[model samples]
Target: MSCLPVCTQRMKELAKERELEHGKRIEWNDWVADNLVVQFEKLVFPRRSQLPRASAVPHWEYSCQRLNHAFVRDEYSQLTLIPSVRENELVLQFHDFETMGQKSDGEIIFLDDITQAQALPSQDSVLHLLPAADEPQSAGYFCRFAIRDRSNANAACITPLNSGLLSRQDRWKRPRYAPSKPIVIDLSPRDLGLAEGFSQAEFDIIAGLGFDSEQDMSWRTRYPTATIYDESPPSVLSHMRRGKLLPPQDVKAGVPKVLIFSETGPLVIGGGEDPYFDLPLLNIINELNASEDDFDFLVSIQPAGILHPQCLPSFAKAVLELLKKRNSVHVFSVRLPDHGISNSQTYIVLLASPICSDVPWPATHLDTKSIEEQICHLKSKNPRADDTHPTAGKHVFLNPAGQVNVYNHGTGQLPDATDRPYFKTVDFESNIILPTLYSDHGWLHPTRHDILTVRECARIQGFPDDYIFYGADKALRSQIIASFPPPIARGIAEAIRKIIKEHTAPGLDASTFAALNLGGRPQKRTRVD
Candidate 1:
């Protein structure tokens, strides 16, 4: 018998005391020596020696409460049979035994057909009876085991344990953390260019957008039916196949019920920004309409990218081409300057003008006034269309030298190098200047120089204050926001909801669908005045 350190110390102490009392130390066979050993063993291994109670840990009911809604399963709780120590009992050890058998002449004798039979209650086996933490002491103190005949499990002598049950009222106790309410966006619709009616009161007014991640993981869980279609690191097909995020379906099943694209059809399907007008996705939609069952779904796209400024009108044309009901296709985007026209037009003027001249550009056949005057008129017509200012914080810089330094307001332009709080984004070779969100910096706060923080970018995109983004870096979070602005998405969704409701209802005229002004492609705007 090996003694613990404390036990060894006490044994030596006892020997020394006995030597003082007697001529020599006490013998091992002596009654006093045996009593000391037993006392030491008791001290080494002490137990609370109390009856098991439900309060030891939260009962199985509490474990169930830890589960998400409709996520309750057996993994929450477990149970296992741990054999207690018994004296001189014959325990047969079978390492490779799986069949039901009995011992006979140093060999195993199988009863009945043993080919399909299996051994139950293996040493490592655990039964998940309830979703609760395992308590070894509870089994030791409260459970009682009875031997049952292997041949007849139905006639087993085991008795039920009734102590685990709690009162009926206790079963409905609240969980440690309550579930949050779903976000609801109520929208008030109006004519085009008039969305600003609610801008002051309803829509969040913030500057800049960011995109760091492709998929918003929260959206997958929050809105399971909403599927994001993008071509990137994780292909749309691969993303849809990931379990729980999308419904299990074959590739031939065609498009999902609700597909959301952060960018327009051309950007996603391929092709660069020079001529940002294409219809690969729209063509697919047109083909899908050939069969009634093929495209019975709603497709929403937000084409607010600088490259595809005309995405709304382009998508509108596609919807117009649809032979079937065009109301199912919707485009949700902010009105911005068309880069194809805006950037090229500005670049042309910059090249034509004399660098030393006070005037910007010469007048053309289109306008009677100078090119600068024409530009000013266009700017006044589209007041909020200037995309050049990196930050929303605007300033008028006046220099006595009058050195002409023009910035492309159509594309994002950084402040001068000498300016305080200045930051320069990495350049892209494909384009002379970076597009709306591709640039490195944004003006989010009224007075800040560094790139927009993730929180500020989220605020600009109309994400709720409480909404949390899942990502490792600011780049990933920025990407997600730039691609999908919740405010714009909500507007489109609201429009779709109304269109769907009206489309399905009886006595609704086909002409009314066109009158909604939410569907169909749009043409270039004529001068209002």
Candidate 2:
């Protein structure tokens, strides 16, 4: 084999070791050459049919290093391939050089027109130049590549070269024909009627604080359709919080085509003196009216606050009434069993659209009784009782009244009969899990006789095990308890997607239509030839 002088030294050492182990002479040079050929073929052959032709190639980088070895082989020296754009075509220049500063002849590959010499499969190879692996367990080389489109400099796709063909089954696809710009307004307590003793200015300042990094990340993952704006000045949130309408220029720039207002908490109707029970809703509505930038659709999810017969109009009912006045509205109820209080709770979801005269409500049926029976069966089998989980196998004592026995750990004794007020144990066979699972006097595990862990509570709320929670244990527990179930949310999302698909005009993009109807401003319709 004609090996580079630098590579010969390392190959000689390896050859000597192998010969000694086999107790025979070996033609190491020929073996190395054959191995290199096999490796090159494996890397280059599979992708021969996939490469696009006559297209402007984006900037990309490919690198390979010797696997499980500190030193790189002479043939595996870094090769920098840079592509320059010429006449809207990609011109890739390939350069090979040694670390010792010796440069070899260079080659240029024209994407639009490849020469006969450059058209060879071996010449077209980029990853195959790396050394071949000797064993199944060991990779001959580790490869990495990145591609960045010139039009979107900030966006880049990076992946392992040996990742093979990735499956698209797990990819999340947005709703087709939906609005291009959708905004989510997460209302706080102050945004509604409950101020918790804070003044209006103070409440606005706190509401304007916006989400933290973790929250921002979680929200983006949860609501892929919603547009999350930067918290910087002159943002949509800033203008909305200050009770100011978006300027015409801003509206024309990227007006929100869909608006989702979310509020989840225990609110009371006529509980406070504030006449405007839904200040945030009113503010947004007023702003849109002033700007004339009506959203294509609006969705609201809010708790059915403490009901009062004398309150006249509850927040949920009032909001529904207001929405119906402006556009076609569909309403749905989401029921949640509050195990902590042994009561059934309900929340309202409203979907409103301007262009569509009638919208179909998303059908959702959750059988709490059936779900409870399944939970009971699983608990009887103790499926989750394993050493891996924190709450597994832990025991708690419950009284006949279904209250947990609060043992005083300091004294190592049970509290006196009078001191131990009966507390309810969570009835997996009857009641659904509630957010108050973290409360000291709240429900205990139906079978385990212990407080429910964050993950256990989250699972009961229809959250996947992989969904991450950030913060202290207490905070995580609270978040899991307070969240709206994912199953119901998904059903609602699917319904909205269907509505968009049915209502949108064919061949016209949603964003283009939105721009044309900006602020309800009338534009002369010109016929295109």
Candidate 3:
């Protein structure tokens, strides 16, 4: 076992940390050659084939540390490039060095032809290396080499090809085609060498991988596909959605809205005023740490078809000032397109908080009615698609008045008075509050509960105890707190800050920064003639 002469002290330390089997050491080039042999065989033969004899490819032990030091110390000029090697158009790079199990980077160099070497047959030939766990060292080496006499090439300068500099005819087919969508491969937990009952979340963390810049881009472009060990196709789709590689189809942007809390009731500002009537909400912007210049995005909270030219300028100015002062704020408008909900009134005074769900009900307040019986009763009454669903009535409470639960309606939009309220238990274990049903219209806890108190809703939304939601009625206060949860707001603000920092980072080109803002795609406009 010959070890390369460089970084001797560090190599010894690494060997101690990552104990080598039997203290066996192998040179970097030998590892590369072994991998190339395995990959080349895979291309020529079927998977699960018996191991073939190693190829006669010449594996020269080159020191990556020495080469990098040569470049750093300006000794590259002393080495001469032979014309024959240049004619062959071979590539040589200091692939990397490893001591024990740790890897250290080496220099990259391009090579061409050399004398007394077997010229590769016209470059369409292939080598496909997939690293195996058994021989960890013989993995990730992606270059093909030609065998030559040791005396023919200089010992001081070794040439290895960069992984991707293939001949025009030698490119791998289907690198892009295969990964167009995520792939699902079935494997049992036992097959993956896992104990019984390994949870899905644990599996995901174990399967996740990180790659370097070059390799990362390569995999992203060539293999955008995700491999799911589970057999379920929906699971694969769900994973991809989480990765943001697949945009969610049902992501409706929340409308810009403003609610003013008062002792009388919660009022939707701007009944007689201009569309930007809630511009006064900008006062809250002073609480943020950022200056006015930091704000770059805006949402207009206008009621439909109610533009006020006279108030427009002032509203715009207020918004600009708010942007300069706050980290992030979103505006939701009262008018929603295709929402089927009414927006006729500019201001709303909710009489009291509606008890849309059973979340606030104590065990003593819950009815003795079995959840199954309630679901069956609800299904019998309202057979409409908007009424019953597979999971809707299960584990969910129903109003004896046959109200529609928000989950059952499935509209991703605000509800109106016509909709009756149905209640469901919050997934308290997961910290997720189910959407509020139209409880103001007589939705009740099985025990006939009323809407949650202003403080209760605030707590569920992750608001601190001190934060208050004061308004006209319990219903109105609940609406204000429920519409915008504190946790959701915090997540959005953090994401915005990160994006802003990336955009404002020094040395980022305009096109790249713009691409980041637009999500790395050319922005297209809807043509309206």
Candidate 4:
């Protein structure tokens, strides 16, 4: 097994005697085995007497949780079809089974209908057909089989075929690893292609994982998606589909709802640097909130990727609840699959930037719960926006080589203090960088670092703490976070609410807000200042 070396090292640490006490030494395969190709479900397990300890093999869920942002740019072509393992399932099988030591002529063999086949579990067929001393495991052996009857599916018979043979004169058909471009096959159901059934973001991820074996199997060779300029991922993750259609929980069918992104956390700055300009974000939100009485929901998403999944949910829920209790606003989090929030029906988006860090930080969740707590401890070191909460830590402001003016929250101020301790900052997993420099943060002088806390990022974008991102990669988390439209920025619903209040009941005015009065598209925001 690929993980054997790691297992061996771990076993030694446990001591031979310590493992013996567990009853018996068992071998388990989690990673791919020495034989490169496999249809794993058919692989047999060892006797229960030699079964491995539950904790010895890693959990698939935990394995997924540790995935980093080592993302391939994107796979623009090809689709995936997960074949079922049910008795009624039909699958493709190929073989060169002539135990008489025969070679195949390089001619291709094709079979159209695969419905008559019954599968032979490796348990009943594997040991009988071992690879020869020189044959590689990837030269797998497969054959078509069918059950005699539904009642006798427990037993099966092999089917006749003009078998594929690589004779002494011709070589076996060598499968190409990379297809410089998408391999377009003439499969049926091309007309049944997905319509509006899948969202853009969900589809991209699915295509990424499926094409690796066929698309990115080599080093050196290049594909367009692997290039930086080509970022559109071609995969679609379908487990995100839903069986039920439920109405949104936080608002009435007629009321205006508002989603906010409010994170603006910061890092240590060096001497005389310009502070970041974070005022426009907050101003936009407050303006919209103040403009209407028809608004029913007030959602806030928190920063995520580092803290537990609750960062988004916790931020959303807290903000929503607080709004509800204080002003009768309703709020909720966007549900996701396998703990990931979905983009479907997500009406607004938040976009925020975290405060510059004095040191380096990682976005890994290897020890998420514990590591997050340590990062939270850093809040005690500075005069943060929410000083009572004590957020992100370990920063010393250096004297900026230059400086500028910046504004944020309710008041605009100059943050010119970088001359303190040498701002040494670090995140839960990132390596070290001294601090960040700023471009428009009120001043021209640069800080020792780049940007802010995940939560602060949430705050700037108006994502309520309750909305969660299904990731541990900071950049992915950021992209998902920023793609949203902050309810405050839109302001259309509320402005319409005011016109409705003076002119009608329940909903808003149609004269100007609705399409009845005039135009094609709604008015667009032309200025940010």
Best by TM-score: 2
lDDT of 4 by residue, 1-529 (tens): 4999997787576554444422221111111122112221121111113222342432223111222212121211111223323432222222222321122211121112112232343432321111111223453333222111111111111222212322233212211111111111100101111100111111110112122322222200212232111111111111111212221232222222233223322212222322342232233334333332222223223222102221323333332323322222112122111111111111211211011001111111222122223223222223553556533223322222242211111111223233112222334332221112221111111232433444333333333333333323333223323333333322322332332233233233333333342211123444332
- Model 4 clash number: 99
Model 1 C-alpha lDDT per residue in residues 314-373, reported as the tens digit of each score: 544444443223221111112211211111111100000001111111112211222222
* Residue 46 shift from truth in candidate 1, angstroms: 94
Error in Å for residue 284 of model 3: 7.0
Instruction: Tell me the whole-model lDDT of each prediction, alpha carbons only.
Output: 0.27, 0.37, 0.26, 0.24
Instruction: RMSD for all candidates, in order, please.
Output: 33.6, 29.4, 31.2, 28.1
List TM-scores for all candidates, in order: 0.29, 0.43, 0.21, 0.17
Top candidate (lDDT)? 2
Candidate with better TM-score, 1 vs 2 = 2
lDDT agreement of model 4 with the native: 0.24
Residue-by-residue lDDT tens digits, candidate 3, 436-457 = 3222322223322333333334
Q: Give stretches of model 4 more than 4 Å off.
A: 1-445, 455-477, 484-490, 506-529
User: Hey, what RMSD does candidate 3 come out at?
Assistant: 31.2
Model 2: ten consecutive residues of lowest lDDT: 196-205
lDDT: which is higher, 2 or 3? 2
